[model samples]
Target: MKQINIFSIIAAFIGLPVLFSSCEDVLDKKPLDLIAEDDVWMDASLAQANIYGMYENLNYFSHWNGDPITYRSGGEGYYGWDYYNSYNSDCQADLYWGHWLSGRGKDDTGWTPSTDFGWDAFSLIRKTNIAINHLTSEESRNSIGVSVANDMLGQVYLLKAAFYFMQARKYGGWVIVDEVLDDIGAVAGSDESAAQKLKLPRATLQETYDYTIDLCEKAANLLNTDAPSGQINKGSAYALLSEIALHGAAYLSYYDGINVDAYYQKVIKSVEELDALKKYSLVSGAEEYKNMFSDYAYAQTCPENILVSQMNESYGYRDAPYSHINRLLVNFGTALLNNNINQSFQSLDKGYSMTNAGAQIQPDPQMVEKAYYVIDLDRKARRFEESQLFAENIDIVMEEDRWVPGAMREKRKLKPTSSYTSISDLMYSRRDQRLAGTFVYDGSEFLGNTIYFRTGGNIHRDSYVDKAREMGSMTGILYSKRVPQYREIVGNLNCTNPIFRLGRCYLNVAEAYLSLSTPNEAKAKEYINKTRVQHGGLPALTTETGGELKMIYLDERVAELNMENDRYLTLLRTALSWGVTDPTTGYPTGEKGGIIPELNRGNNPTKKLEIEVPGDYMVEEDFMKPNAYFYREIQVPQSDHNFIFTPKKRYLLPVPQSELIENENLWQNKNWE
Candidate 1:
């Protein structure tokens, strides 16, 4: 999205902050001061300027503060958009790290619904409502071209629906404010009725769903199917509808005591509609797949991206800072791009960007287990043979440490470097291409240097060791999806975050079919095969039922959508389907114990250090024997770090205390008080 000078015109009249602009390629100018309400509708460009502001104001990563890789413990921050923040890949450590100790409050004591994303939405909703009112006014058709007006109006509805969908999912049912609250003075003045009108209570869950779906329907009717990546088109609208419809069906099936095959059918149809557009498809090949996340340019045009949050550029007029996901994956003093020399003398440039590594958010051991299971990587060596795991396979290790297979030609052609051999190279060589592509494995030739992250390696250790202890032991698996190889010189970290992907649609369709009474296993298998069998090269899932199939479907999500902000919602919705009922006394009044508890169960493993006697000091026979040294002591659980989440209390966040205080009619959600 790009900023324009049109804010001078709009802000002068409306007093809104001028922090937004257009997301398109062109900008048109019209005289600002002369544009009255009557004249504004006559000029299409002016109406569009306001609409453009709406696009700019839509909550993208750049718009929100706080690290995307870590949740801010002081609740949702000022913007109150904690849904994705709490659910993003960064927050997975909370189960062990205790990041979310408080439930939407400064401390564990106070939390209210108003401070949540549900209430944060009113800011954007009001802006969009104003755009909708203006664009749909009787004079709008006369002022702008009918087709163009409808296109702009379609965007407004789409955005409005998105806000409503977010609110409905997070805050259950809240009051719907569709009309424009334009006249601030009139609404805030000493009139009791006007103030009373704004104090409406929550709406029904069904009503919120219906309203959101209706807006999407209107958007699908008005917008073009082949819209730009940044813009909301029919395909995007349908994709969102498919997701919303699935949620509605899931909610109704378990919570509302309603059977919703109709919703499941709707999900299938919506996904089909998106597919019919033929605009986007998954990027194929392992290198290309990894690049789809790291390379901004490649991802912008990648068919897999249905919707995205685009950062303009870096070091330019509109250059936005890149997301520092790389820093979150690697440890400090750990050379990136494979420069693993222990001692750093002067003039030694590693040619890679080194990070602070303090904020590194390693994958949960459970998540690593799931990933390994998804790709079927053999961990036999890791399971039972500890010595064989890390030892260099001198006999099988390729000459000059040519770790990667099928690279013998390159090995023969080029002279050997100072790189050493290790068992990690052999292990990585046997894994699925996607696993190698998505994570930083123990040994891989990154750029030119061999990357290593094992214990006692050349890389510096910080909390990596502690986190490993927390997870029982480190698996040497770290996130690498968005960690670019050339980040230091790549100009911008502004790779458009993939907000929607057709691959996900395929998975969703499969789940929807499987969720039916007479499970459409064949149909589910067909859809699942499109990505898993064809792209991933994994064997087709044949016969599975009940919990087994659900687990498979969920594992697929973990493999495909980790760190993309889908996990939290996946866990929440799945828990609902598990028939979670309102507890008699707990805070999770109407929620279920889902995959989160399962993932967080059990204590992590601990590792012991071994020492060998020096050859000179030991007898010849004694030299061969191993002696147990000392193991690292377990950390005493700190009050904050020792947090144990009560499912009922922690699942749904509370409204802001301010909201409760201001609105006498608005009470807190269930046990939050």
Candidate 2:
């Protein structure tokens, strides 16, 4: 027997009141009371406000006080919006390891179908649908002015399509609901039950993509070419369309009655349209590229940002303070740079490579001594300067007793010494400029602090032994990409979260070219080289076979978009393209395909280095010896690798068990039942 509809169940849970009241009672409200539904459409500003409510769902970070708008809804703890990205990175990507020993890794059997997908943004879709219905009505168009109504409708369409796109990429096909429905228990005028009206069957994967594409096109047509910052425009619509089409093309064989080539062409075409607008370009220079992601004010005017989620200092404070990207990475230790990512960056000469082979060779003793001397000199100078400044700024006051000192005032408090001279800096020097911009390694300067990831450093250290297993970068490096470096306070960062940018668009076009039937290697090389040469500060790629070029493209993507949550998605898409089959049906899973079974676990060896203590340096921790020692990279022990293999069914998350129970029409993903 059919059960309740998922939307109706969600509606009841969220306490969505009846949207419309009787016409007779509409005028009974006072001026300060809630505006009637009819009044909302009559005013352009009210209609615009209705659309803006949906924008709240676009933020990737959870609110300070654990606002339930973006991700899972428990306090501002582990269930924040960044949790899903961190979870995926920890389990799958080569850029991170979520401490497999603790059972948070891919081999953890505790992960199950009951896990929250965190992309159930249907509530946003419902709101968008309601707004669409209002904005498209003849009365609304006449009252709010046709131009205003069309613009609002454009935003609504983009939002509706965006919500569907998020779900479709994860779960494939979904139930399509374009119209608002009555509450589950609302009275029905017809003989048909309200449950029957609400129970909609899932559409085919092909139909879902087609409908989403249509909505994107509609939005592109209605939206203005230019929009205010943080608002949707034709460029945003086309950028999203390009991304959606790229995913469709990746899973080409899974969809019936669809041409994979056509999807690729669609991606190219959408990107081409966005390019024709002549509004965006990749930010030049390494500093500019870093600033594009790290600085909020720069991002607003940066041509690279086609779409971005505007964040501010105020967002960090609410009912309960929410953690921002900086706090999550530094304070909570949610993710760290998996030492493996360092190899992706090219050296300044573009010929010398930082690889495992190079890492195995020990540095010359003379060079090591020089590095230590420079490190010590710099540390001593900084400390003396800090002490002098502190002495200059303090004001001693008399207390109640004798001439006792009161509260001493200082301009700025210096960060604790977290660095000791290490040989790893020699290895990292002269590599890609982006490496320094993206990660905080031993001896790196960040926000007036020398960040240390050494074994016994002050701020943080690599935890190998069980007793020292505290919240720190287990991989000996912290992911600093897109993290605002100038924020003096941890959670006060006001960085803009980039949703879509020209750099990604160029890569999408390049990937499409390489993925075409004929394989346009030249075209692919051209598009990929734009960002590689401009942002990476490296030479343009040379000629190569389609397959070789594809490999190069993946590496370039990793170098450019590593910690931006693109690695996991790219890995999944690559698996699909390799003809990986669905676990249950033995069909091509497309973008939902799992990585190679042998490579599913976190197998990247953590890096470590051991160095002799220079002078009279004493470690604060009693666990360390006062004598010689330095840290270097080493493989994790085999005993720690005792993880169960990930089941194939985990590639695509299961439709929430709660939804499955409430809506019998909703089916579990393949192999999930």
**What is the TM-score (0 to 1) of candidate 1?**
0.72
What TM-score does prediction 2 earn? Answer: 0.70
All candidates' lDDT scores?
A: 0.51, 0.54
- Report residue 98 deviation for candidate 1 (angstroms): 9.0
- Listed in order, each prediction's TM-score against the native is 0.72, 0.70
Q: What is candidate 1's lDDT per residue for 328-358, written digit by digit as tens? A: 3443323231333333321113543443332
Regions of model 2 farther than 4 Å from truth:
1-33, 60-92, 99-108, 111-121, 184-191, 254-258, 317-323, 328-426, 450-473, 579-594, 597-599, 602-647, 656-664
Candidate 1 ranges with C-alpha deviation above 4 Å: 1-42, 56-120, 182-192, 312-322, 326-350, 355-358, 374-422, 460-475, 487-492, 579-595, 598-643, 657-661, 664-668, 671-673
- Summarize candidate 2's per-residue lDDT along 110-205 as a digit string, tens digits: 556676655355555666766887888899999999987887899889888877776676667878987665544222254346776666677767
